[model samples]
Target: MRTAQPRHYLMCRPTHFDVVYSINPWMDPRKPVDTPLAIAQWESLRQTYLSLGHTVETIDPLPGLPDMVFAANGATVIDGRALVARFRDAERIAEGPAYLQWLREHGFADARTASIVNEGEGDYLLAGEWLLAGTGFRSDPRSHAEAQEFFGRPVIGLTLVDPDYYHLDTALSVLDEKTVAYYPAAFSPGSLAVLQRLFPDAIIATDADASVFGLNAASDGYNVVLPHNATHLIEALRERGFNPIGADMSELLKAGGSVKCCTLELRSAG
Candidate 1:
């Protein structure tokens, strides 16, 4: 198989009911949330995406899973080849099946998880023949190799050093057709060398930037997704001739997710 990278991501719409620990009473959680700021952020995120000339698809009446916004967390798409994920987190296992159903309905071949053990989709990246995966924390090694075989790819397993950089999306992303955004410290020395070899001119994010908005959040060729008030990082991105696009994802972060988590691109993702 060839390297598969997303050209566009599928973002869902959020309502009071869709949010984890949402204001809605029906969806059970920590309690009714006072997440007005998160709501505002989501609106701005929608706007920022539109400004970039991309249409945002809303998954109105969002379904099961406590933190389902990480759509990419549950679905792995290779050349439009859909493999619905099976999350280690019980709360999010529902999302993978849901995505699989979508693929079946749309005339696509779908794959399923063997058990309730695979980690979230953010832990994995389809980098060429090697499946760059985060092996510690949320995603484990057992499932990592399993995913490689299922996709007919080699697994370049990377362990997460700390909790903050828990997911691959939080640390690494393809910034453009050639460049990538990454934080080497979060990865093991071997994986760090691997990424550098793959993307020689990659932008290594500052620790401050990664914590602020997840440096490798989302990207569309030269365009990238970031959080609000990322003035400094935005400047750096601009200096690199990148279009730093901001989106509201306060609610997503509250649930341990973000713009990068919200969607998974299918079709010719590269």
Candidate 2:
């Protein structure tokens, strides 16, 4: 179960990518984003997943919803059960409906929709059998209870204090069923203590790597797809027997997301 094998994933083409507004600390509307470079970078990631023998599907991009390219925010799928997102911000409110429509039309017609304000996989991450849900930022803690009830899984609500690491997926990555990598400073004292207790052997990322959104990386149990700037985290992962592969997602970082943000795992149907 811990071995690396081909996985199913969903991605969105960065056709209208841009940083027109600042939702997180990493975003700056004043900073110019290279749309073409972003597209190429997203394509490279998509191809990387394909090269790894993973199935890569896509969602059609909407014109005005620039952040829709971060498909992981659209929904969180586990064993074919999709918990569609309900974005907290008004700017991204339209994205939830669009993604839900796609899921309904696709194979996920039976997927359950969310009533609570949640950012889908942006705040909810599946690590092992537990659902690690982040709060105190984009998502509400009320959504955590809702997620737990919907999935019938234990959900741990962690509070994020830093604006730079607004999302749980941005602060922590579920490398395998047992192993996780995270940035301690991004979480509150209580949340950090909880993480330490839950994952005693978790890889701790330094400020240098965390600053580059290294914890936002994704793993297929065997290999880790991370940002190229996260040299420290890359070396750390190598020490743990994981093959760390770096991707140039700097263009997408302007929108406060990286590899994991652009990729959503569609677990095999049970």
Candidate 3:
């Protein structure tokens, strides 16, 4: 049976949430965005974490950074050390320094901005002692080496093939130290082979679930929070002894993010 663990997370309110420019397949400038509704949805996520005994910390939202609500892209925090992101898109360039400053001011003395293009936890996820790094769209391949050096973990590089799953967090989620849930088609043949060798018993998501950002869920060892529309994944998670909590990230999904996108786990050293 899976046991729940209390986690610490960093979040940013969707105070200025909007899709003024398109960066991914899910975003469109012509689509109407309701800032208030986005905030409400984000709040529900934060509250869900709080009710589950997870600590939630917030960073003030900058007016011009509409995508700031997707806090998981800000930085990768492990053992109290942070590697801030260097965004691939010019639209998110300033986010790097903003996240760096937050880390520095918030007691992360070992934090430093990444020299190469990498969108923080959006591409870097920790599974046991392995650091799963993703590239092909947002993060550069070289950043994988940098993350290995910074975090002192064996980095396993994975290539994302689908544009819809631009970030690794969008196509895969680390369910626990030893298990993960992913959509196989989003990865390249080589990456898929690597995953199969590494996690022979991983939970596989269908196209119907992955299409609704289901793989972007977050797990606290036991409870998996994902998009409500991802019905298949919900049942799959339950069959594996996980408590699946359905969340409504429809408003946020318009910009290519859901639960995991809004939550950045702050892993500290023992």
Candidate 4:
């Protein structure tokens, strides 16, 4: 893989991260969470992005919104326009306006609320010119059509089937402009075939990698930011000529998210 121009990302400080509610299958309210460790891990991820020459911006983490630390679910920024999420879960409903406000306050002049239920970048991933929209879980398939009209980009809707892989980000990752990595079992046979037809040379991750959220990674064409436990994925990326940077986000995994969940791309308009 080759290096591309550094990208800008939006992040939220894990000031109040805790698994207070069980919205996803990964969340366990009975398990004890270490808040300080979570903050430290999140900071390490921020610093890693900075080290790789990427810009990192922040949104204020509101009290009582534990999942706010997973900033990638807040909104999808492309060409300086933000399609803010309309969360499917009531617990996360407030995040829609909160993120839209942050985007507007920042540089996203075109930021607006999404009509259909969606989970922002967690469901809608930008892979080069294509917008890969994940449905059958947190995001509605209708939002894909809306996103196509809003961004004027081709949107491919893929339906997810596995309960553990509730969000597309949990099942798939855009490795570079032309390549991707995904868990084939996470999607329906039709959706898997569609992805295979689209990305014939895409990397196929094993169950082990998918279980650790290895597919939930952020790549800059040259460098991939992923969880520390995904050793196989790191080796795989290295073999493909891309540098793999690892950051421990085990504490945040209690809420069913990892490194990719903590970062949202802020693409330029031009």
Model 1 residue 153 lDDT score: 74
Give each model a TM-score: 0.80, 0.98, 0.99, 0.98
Q: TM-score-based ranking, best first? A: 3, 4, 2, 1
TM-score of 2: 0.98
lDDT, candidates in the order shown: 0.64, 0.91, 0.94, 0.91
Number of the top lDDT candidate: 3
Clashing pairs in 4: none
Per-residue lDDT tens digits for candidate 2, residues 70-151, read 9999988887788999988888999988888888888886676688888989999998889999998888899999899888
Candidate 3 on 91-122: residue-level lDDT in tens? 88887888889889988999998999999999
User: Candidate 4's residue-wise lDDT over 1-270, tens digit each?
Assistant: 388569899999989898878888999999999999999999999999998899999999999898999999999989988999999999899988899999888878998999999899999999889999999978998899999999999999999999899999999999887999999999999999999999998888889889999988999988898887888888888888888888788898999999899999999799
Clashing pairs in 2: none
Order of quality (lDDT): 3, 4, 2, 1
Better of 2 and 4 by TM-score: 4
Q: Pick the candidate with the highest TM-score.
A: 3
Off by over 4 Å in 4: none
Candidate 1 residues 76-161, lDDT tens each?
77765656677665556666676667666655655565443555458777654556777666766787767766777777777777
